[model samples]
Target: MHFDFTDLRLFVHIAEAGNLTQGAAQTFLSAPAASARIRALEAGLEAQLLYRGNKGVSLTQSGETFLRHARIILRQIDYLRDDFTGSDSDTSGHVRIFANTTAITEFMPEVLAKFLASRPGVTIDIQERLTQDIVRAIRDGTADLGIVSGDVDQTGLEAIRFSTDRLLLAVPEKHALAERKSVGFADTLAFEHIGLHDGSTLLAFLRGLMEKNGYDRALRVKLRSFEAMCRMIEAGVGIGIIPESAARRHTKTMRIALVSIDDSWALRERYVLVRSLAALPGAGRALVDELVQNAAGGRK
Candidate 1:
């Protein structure tokens, strides 16, 4: 219960890096030293934090909860440092955004690049999560803002239109459904599916879609990226649901067909969801401006 900032930060780095040696190196400690420190920390907390594996470590359920609070505390410290040390004209602060998979994979990289170039003291952290979770995190002060999709209920939060998102079924060229121009989400559910990993936001959304339609799906295999999903589909494993942008991009080279998902929820306008625009820090507001301005400039 009496953990110091160093141990908390060490845990964050370890959880993010998924490797003890790499995380230790970030904190300028050796592997053995980091291991001892982690053991001591765990002993003090009386809770296991990480699940060790042959390839790397993953967060236990306790670790996930611990990491969330650790991040909030660490980020608040950074914000406090910036507030007192930063100049009035300088936009210097930390902005953490929780977004869905489409926003993370398709839109954020270039915006982040441009945002970072002019602001020397601004830092950003982006995580993928379900839109419902994103809204809760924003309300609870765990996240500065969020980018969400679909017709999700945002009764309490401010929603700004930033971009559009659509999900398409990626089927192999010779598959029975590929010849069809469009297919309903329910129709696709009966077939085995290839999907992103279990924790991916897109996979979670697809699962929710299935549940909403009162269908149970079997994901034949799970991979890390859209391309991998396309590859699996091409190899006749199963069809996959991927972002329209990704489907178009992958279909040009891969032997896959993009079939529209004929569901209202499949076609969605992405929104920047926040508690209040006026309450955001300068850096956070700047990021919001960046997103909407990009959309205005036809950069969705």
Candidate 2:
């Protein structure tokens, strides 16, 4: 009843080899040592675990019952060790990432796919939030990495430029602006525009782009999600501005036409990689490297 795992291992070894000498050879123990271990286990369990004969050894009735339990225990320990060891070198632990809807839907999937393909044992948890929420998650230690569209003001975060995505004007295929070669800031203002929420970094960037191009009025919209923006455009509710990547993905199958904006504004917005200024785990570092390399290679 008070047996340790070594006793159980001795029992299993004896069961498989059916003799002390052979079992000792398999386990790298001397024959005498292996015999002593089996004798000690039998004595502790108060069961004659083996019957010695001229040719070999066979299990007694009590040994037959104990062998079943012994094998199960050894297998369980093997599994426990394998699980712990895997978490070390194989990047088998959990990693968390935060991003807004655009980054999650359009960009993060491709990056995650590549990371997962290489580190198949690792599990990733992704959370979608607005830009401010994404930064806040990193600052609060709730997320290991953050993907956001614009600059974050948090003090202890390290940000790196990964890729550039252009912001585009999209309209329903039949809409008047759909056929235009390009739209200017003044031209956009004349339309009932679809836009992200005022708090979104996309909205902030769009506002700055408008201001830089000398548009003095507010851009109007009833929703925040690109899907919602698409729905509005499909209904001809208004023309909308969105990341070109998003437009390309969601609108390709829809009746939408994407147009470029010709303004003095920064034509491309950045997709930035952010992590705590504190040290990152090896897995996180690997992920960051993959993301930057993929970005440089122009993958999504």
Candidate 3:
């Protein structure tokens, strides 16, 4: 049986919008045209696809199953179109990347800029998420690539080294902890702390450590970005725990001191993860190759 791509696309839109009129408008089809197409599709499949209610429309059980397959088919068609028409010198496609805060703050900007500069036809959609969320998105095929903390569970994903950076105790230049070469987690409890926003991966990890060691201390302030956190530390608002890469850059002009953490968790290793390197689309594979090559060359 032949299924029209237009019908499949319309079905997906309606399923997502939950309103036939809105979906039809979004797809640029009149209400009657949209209804006829959906009915035709149902006739071809010999299954009820939608349940109409006073409020809106919803997918039937069969519709849910077909929606998943329809999305896959559309994605494959996009890949095929790009592969056949795009040239090696002008490879064109879209890559969806999900990354953690550490990777976003410490890496990715230069690498992505370089990749985009070379591939003018390629586009990237990036989302910032925690490591575990990035892993989940990769497993679900919602993202083509992921950069995540290496400590997270990556049981089914293939990962390559992306970057290496570590967390450090950041303090004001004249703070009491500034003189110490290394300090334990417990020792830092005496001072007010600057921290990332609640629910951040780093903040969660630090909280876990505090709970494990039975240390309780409230944050003096919570900020969103590493730059803001470092600035706060420089202003002596409070000491903070930040990535060494970020701290190193800020310390050039900011009056901040980076003290070593005696904890093993301070040493961070990040990796680029994907469902499978071989399964990635051509553009994604190219970008991944560039990232891996850049990282390897950096080590050398």
Candidate 4:
């Protein structure tokens, strides 16, 4: 019932680090001291906050719920500090963002650069995740904001249209599928495919599609970026699926052919999600504004 500032700070550190020893070191407390503090906190709240494991620690459902409130409390404390200090020159806070690969790769660089330039004291931590994962991170309060593909559910979150891009199948100029104007995803599965790395949202989505069709996608080659995938396809390593914007750019330079994906899901849109606009920290709300404005301008 009566946890102090130190307790909240320590809890935040531990949740972020997901390692007891490391979190303790960050707080400049020994492991034993940190563990005792956490125990006291749990006892006071009558709820277990962490699931300690061999690999690392993770939040329980209650822990996740508590973390959301903890972050809001911490942000409020920061606001109080800024108010008393009268430090208008530097408006500083941390905003954590989780976004899908498409949004990260295709949309965010310029927008983030603009936001960071305007608020020099603000810092952002960005993670690339799949759409569903982004939603979960936002829902769990692990992230301040999320940018996700619109095809995913957004039942409980406030979402705004962010951007739109489509997926295209890229193949070697001489590949059998190259002559086709468009093809189903299943039609391309027989050929060895090039793909982005395993954790990429695009790759995960494709894998899910293959799974739904009762087959495994054979990713014979995996590359780190769209350009790399294009080069692999050019060399006949394998065909690949890539964002149409990237495919159009790469096709001009490489001896590759792009065929429209004959699937409804290929044409994708991105959405920026937040638990509540009013609840977001100053910097996070600013970023949301920038993303929404940019998307609107693009539409015009």
Error (Å) of candidate 1 at residue 160 is 2.3
Q: Which stretches of candidate 3 lie over 4 Å from their true place?
A: 1-74, 80-90, 297-300
Give per-model CA RMSD.
3.7, 18.5, 5.4, 3.6
lDDT of 1: 0.84
lDDT of each: 0.84, 0.72, 0.82, 0.82
lDDT of 3 by residue, 1-300 (tens): 567888878988898799888889888999999999998889989999999999999999999888767766776677677667653233677788888777666667878888889788888878778767788878777677998764878899898876676889999999999999999978888788889887577887787787887667677898888999999999999998898878888999899999999988788787889888886777888888887787777730
Question: Model 4, residue 89: displacement in angstroms?
Answer: 11
Residues 76-138, candidate 4: write the lDDT tens digits.
Answer: 676566557764232467788988776777668878887788788898889898878788877
lDDT of 4 at 101: 78
Candidates, ranked, lDDT? 1, 4, 3, 2
Clashing pairs in 2: none
TM-score of 1: 0.77
Per residue, candidate 1 scores C-alpha lDDT tens digits across 1-300 of: 577888888998999899998999998888998998888888988999999988989998989888888877886776576567664222677788998877788779988898889998887889988777898887766798888888778888888888788788899899999899899988987788888987777888888777887766567899878888888898899988888888888878899988988888888888998888776777888899999998888766
Candidate maximizing TM-score: 4
Give RMSD (Å) of candidate 2 vs. truth: 18.5
What alpha-carbon RMSD in Å does predicted model 1 have with respect to the real structure? 3.7
In candidate 2, what are the lDDT values of residues 1-300, reduced to their tens digit? 477876676666767678778877777778888888888877888889899987778999998778766654564454355456653343655566777656766777888888888887777878666777777667655566788764457466788777876778888899878889888766877777778765665676567767875767566565757888888888888888887777887776678898888864535445444554235555666777877898878765
